[model samples]
Target: MAPVSHAADRVQSLDVYLNACKIGTIVRTPGDFNAFSLDPAYRATGGTPVLSLSLRAATGGLRRDPRPLAGALPAFFANLLPEEKLREAMEKHHAASVRPGNDFDLLAALGADLPGAVRVVPTEGARAVASAQAPQPPRLRFSLAGVQMKLSVMKNTGKGGGLTLPLEDGQGQYIAKFPSLTFPGVAENEYANLALAAALGMDVPARELVDKADFEGIPEEFDTLSDGKVLLVKRFDRGQGGRRRHIEDFAQVFGLYPSRKYDGAAYHDIAAALTMAVSPAAALDFVRRLALCAVTGNGDMHLKNWSLIYPEGDGPPALSPIYDMLSTVPYLPADGMALTLGGERSFKALTPSRWKAFANRARLPEPAVLAAVAATAARVNAEWWHLPERAAIPAAVLARIDRHITLMLPILAECGAG
Candidate 1:
């Protein structure tokens, strides 16, 4: 993969790496178009495909030609960078990286120290990861797309257990989320909902809902109320001792930007992508999670919330540990499922026929599809109902959940019929 030369440090190419080994190069053509090609040696090494199914051909390698992306970074490289306010913050911190109408330069700025093993180094000198020079609190607008206000943080060792503070530039070990003024009891709401998903046997990350008083150096706006709760979630993409493992959300996998994250992809497309890119077991896991999302009345499983994880050395990717698992039914009472399933987005209308269509669309074996559906339905019936109340979820929010349960009964009924 030889890089073409350009005039006066225009940054036309970037070297791509998986861990320590160089894998490929991404280039910005004369017209600000993004194109990519893998190292011929890298493909021969029995290493897993770096980009996703959309970019790489079905035979498991990048297409013979370099191609421009339809959305953000080449499907594999997009989510490695931050989004929304985090994007704004990173841009403000590294002013040189932001050139109007140039996407590749912005990528070059955020490429160093990305989420997973994949690193993007500019044709120039090594780039510093985008972050504040020192650890800073939630001073910059902390709001992201979600209703709840959240920030990237590290587990604070100074106060010992049950304390976390802002993490900047360096690898963040956790994500700190606070209650919502619009949605009351969201901390407890998300906590109880995540617990339900865990009971159904998902690889959920570590999370705890703590009293607001336990944290220090945080802006009071984090929790909205002085006595509210704060949710501290361990970063699944970061391993022991802050090592960065490779991870990419469905948004990045499909080459969609954050603005298009919700509308750009559908659940059927996600399932199809998983079947081609990952193992049979990993594909089955995706089916199971989709089933759980339907029964739980979670209408917010957008592209950003779904992700894939790659193991250390050479290994095929698998669905990452589930994060952002919360039931939005209580808050967005009028909303339906975030992404469409089998040509429809309504949970109530996802009949067995549609599910079978989804299975066929995903190219999944009928037996595996049936098994995943059965497992999810049985688990929800056995373990879901009592969770929120037992978790001591607030009464008003619990009532909304109860109402959502009544509304979502059709999905459970369909599963029970099978």
Candidate 2:
């Protein structure tokens, strides 16, 4: 790694690697936008160990071109970094060196530990451009794309089982999501929601709500949030011995920028993609998760939330495990879903007819889709009340979820889910 350059005119370029093999180069154009081109050797190998679904052409070949990256990194790369408050926090923490909203520089700073197997490093003579003269702090050199303040921490194998920042060259095994000032009890809410999701037979990652003090390296401000607890979820893309599997979110698949995660695509689009690229069973799993979201009032399942994991790092894609499943209605009672379902966005609008309509549009069998919805609804109604995790939720929030499920039962019952 070269010393951070301060020259305004110096070209900024990064080598993109997957599984430690260089695949392409992303260059910050003279116009300040980014452009990427495949490395000749990697291109000759026929795009093995797939990088992203978005990078594939409609003919099922890699799309090879270079153009202005539109004031940010391409959607796939852009979605790899944190957003909103988390991004602001990182920028503020490294204010003296990294610029605010500069995706290229952010990637150079934290690329070694991005989600999946992809890693970015500055190309020789093309280094990250820093601004101020103040000495910078140690880089928080891992990126997890989301607005929430979370850290990619490694679990200690000692008796107490604490979590801390990954040691040099070590990978984070769990994602520790901290309590948020804006959303109280989110950690507990998510624990209850994930418990319900797992009981409903959705494939969810292993998770637990642990004391915040058990986690080290969390910044002071986030450490002092709503409660003394944080949600720790095992990383699905990582395997034993820290082997990396590749993954890309639906936003990357559809080539939509992260800001447009709620637009330019719908739930039907995702189902259709699953049916086409993955298996019919994968599509059915998606339907079940969608039903879970509706039953739990999880309004934040945007394109970025749904992802495809390459099981073998070079293998075909499958739906990743359920994550970020908090009941948002307790926070914003009027909020709708992050993406539309059958042209409707309201959770109250979920009906059997809508499921049928969605099945028709998504090219899935209507009966299978309806069966998934019924199964998910039945499981939620049956299992949620008995889950011990529900006791951890705040009383008011629990009551809100109770009311939400009660209101949802009628529509689900019409599908014979009750």
Residue pairs with backbone overlap in model 2: none
Using alpha carbons, what is the TM-score of model 2? 0.92
Candidate 1: 10-residue stretch with minimal lDDT:
136-145
lDDT of 1 at 186: 75
Q: Please report, in order, the local distance difference test score of every candidate based on alpha carbons.
A: 0.67, 0.82
RMSD of 2: 2.8
lDDT tens readout by residue for model 1, 1-418: 2222222135668898877777788877665667787777876754454544445656855556546764235645654555544455455544444553344655665555565666677755433333444433322211122334566666556636555453323555677777666677777777777788888778988888877666666643344553567777877777887676777778877767667777998887888878767876788888888887877678888998888887776667889988887777777876678887778888778777767778788787766676677668777777867665335677877777777766655565564464
- For model 2, how does the per-residue alpha-carbon lDDT over 1-418 read when each residue is reduced to its tens digit? 4346423245477889998788998887776878888998878777787887777777866887657776688778989999988888767655554688888777776778899889887787775545565434455678899999898899888887778887435689889888877878889999999988888777899999998878777766335466646899999988899888888999988988889988979999999999888988899899989988888788999999999988674467899888889889999998777898888878889888888888999999888888888877888889999999999998998999888888887776566543
Predicted structure with the largest TM-score when compared to the true one: 2
TM-scores for candidates 1 onward, in order: 0.78, 0.92
